[model samples]
Target: MSEPIPTGCEGVDELLGGGFERGVVTQLYGPPAAGKTNLALSAAVETAARGDSALFIDTEGISVDRLEQLASARTEDVEDLASRIIVSDVLDFDEQGEAVQDAEEFAEQVELIVLDSATGFYRIRRTEDEEAGDALRTVAQQVTHLLSLARKHDLAVVITNQVFTDPDSDRARPLGGHTLTHWSGVVLRLERFRGGNRRATLEKHQAKPAGETIQFKITGEGLQSVEDVP
Candidate 1:
């Protein structure tokens, strides 16, 4: 088995028994302000730092300032590290799906593939109940493509997602549901907690039992794990 990609976040890595697994799709889902994107960026840095290029499909714009802050610990030349990540800015859901589907053309060149917020445009176009199911089907199909692409190339795939909340019960869950979750071998959910800390829950995994969690804060440098978090 290939070694897991160590996300610089200390505690969370320990929780996963090393880091994110390669040759499979891992889903990171969370509500707004839960730091799902922060964790995704951290993975890109870790994966790209391994001496190979990475592909970052940016549905939401990435912050170079944040990259500089996060990459500073690993290399003096943040620009060099940043350069290793080939970013594709996708404006709409159709464009997003195309970017993910077409990634196979360059699969051999990258070690890590990240789609930050796979559901950004998905939610926008599917706001009404009638269109949500079709949107979900499209997302699920695209994720399956990513799953096959990851295994075919032995790449570590990370896709961030937003949650859908039901007004009746005030319950929130990952938007794509079982259809999307099935494709990911590992699923981690981020939840906002008190005092600027985020809780990362291991919802599904191959080795580690589910429901184990860790708390961390987004620092100037990157994510810092907390102790005795509430």
Candidate 2:
């Protein structure tokens, strides 16, 4: 059998059946202000706190200062955790591929690699009038390359994605659609719930059967497990 994946949060780890399985790509999708970045940051902090190095590739200009503030405000050993975290930004496919390769090489010494706002990496290639097919193809190639890196290196890959509203369809969907959904081993959707709380629902997973949804809260410390909303 394959090794179990580790979710950075204890509560989440239990829910995920030990942890996210190693050597698989997990996608975290949410709309703007849905606490997606917070989840990623929390995971990175947790990984580093466990003495495992983590690399974060930022495509949306995720503020390093904000990460520092969050780390200092929440973690017990902020300085030590911060020391284990690394950040990179990729502006195009070429740069992104190089970053993924570098990250894979780095993963030999680390436990996790996070692509913060993975979808935004494709924005560099988008034109105002670009066709949907072309955009999908571009994103597919990038996801494929990243997944290969993750598997080859035996490291967990977590990618954050932006959600898009479907005007005609009632169901909410991710921006990259099937290309991303198919490539990923797990797909999670995050959203704000009542009382300003947020929920992380399992939209899809291949390892084991998962329920429709799960709930979590965002505190100044980061995401914490909450009772699932009925």
Candidate 3:
């Protein structure tokens, strides 16, 4: 069996009972500046640092500067590690679907698939049809496809998402709704923490109880546990 993959964060790995399972899908959601992209990039960095490949199908452009900064501390040759990490950017939902389909080509070499912001275009292209019938269906189909790829290839999958404000509760929730929550094996909600840090709450998990919380800081060295920094 493939080994469970570490997310490059000690606290998150602890929450997952070591790390992410090969066939599981992890969903990360949070407000702006909550470190979603940093987490996603860190996953890629972790994979590439291990001399494995990662396919990042991005709906938004990745931050190259941040990626370099994260990789430098882990490996002597940041360029080599970055080379093993391939990035495929999609402009909208149609392109996003196509990108996932094309990802199969790299299955043999890739250990992880990070789909950053799974619902970017869905949010933008959503019709006045409040139910978003057709759009929601697309999200379901694509997510299922990604999960199937993970299981068949024995690779991990991580998908980030934007948040939507719940009018009734005045809370921010993951954008893809039940479609995302149903398929993901683990779901983490990131929020601002005290002292320039972030908190990750295990909102859902297949094998673990929910509501576990951990606080960490993001820096050039990557995500660091700040448990003692009260």
TM-score of each: 0.94, 0.86, 0.94
lDDT string for model 1 (84-141, tens) is: 8888889888899899988898799887888887888888877755588888888888
lDDT of each: 0.85, 0.73, 0.86
> Candidate 1 — number of clashing residue pairs?
0
Clashes of each: 0, 3, 0
The residue pairs found clashing in candidate 1 are: none
Q: What clash pairs does model 2 have?
A: 5-19, 5-20, 5-21
lDDT of 3 at 72: 96
- As for candidate 3, its clashing pairs are none
Error of 2 at 85 (Å): 0.8
Any runs in candidate 2 off by more than 4 Å, and if so which? 1-8, 73-77, 91-94, 121-127
Least well predicted 10-residue stretch by lDDT in candidate 1: 125-134
lDDT of 2 by residue, 51-162 (tens): 7788888777776676776677656777887998888887765676678667756867777788877777465455354665776686677677777867877777888888
Question: How close is each model in CA RMSD to the real structure?
Answer: 1.6, 2.6, 1.7
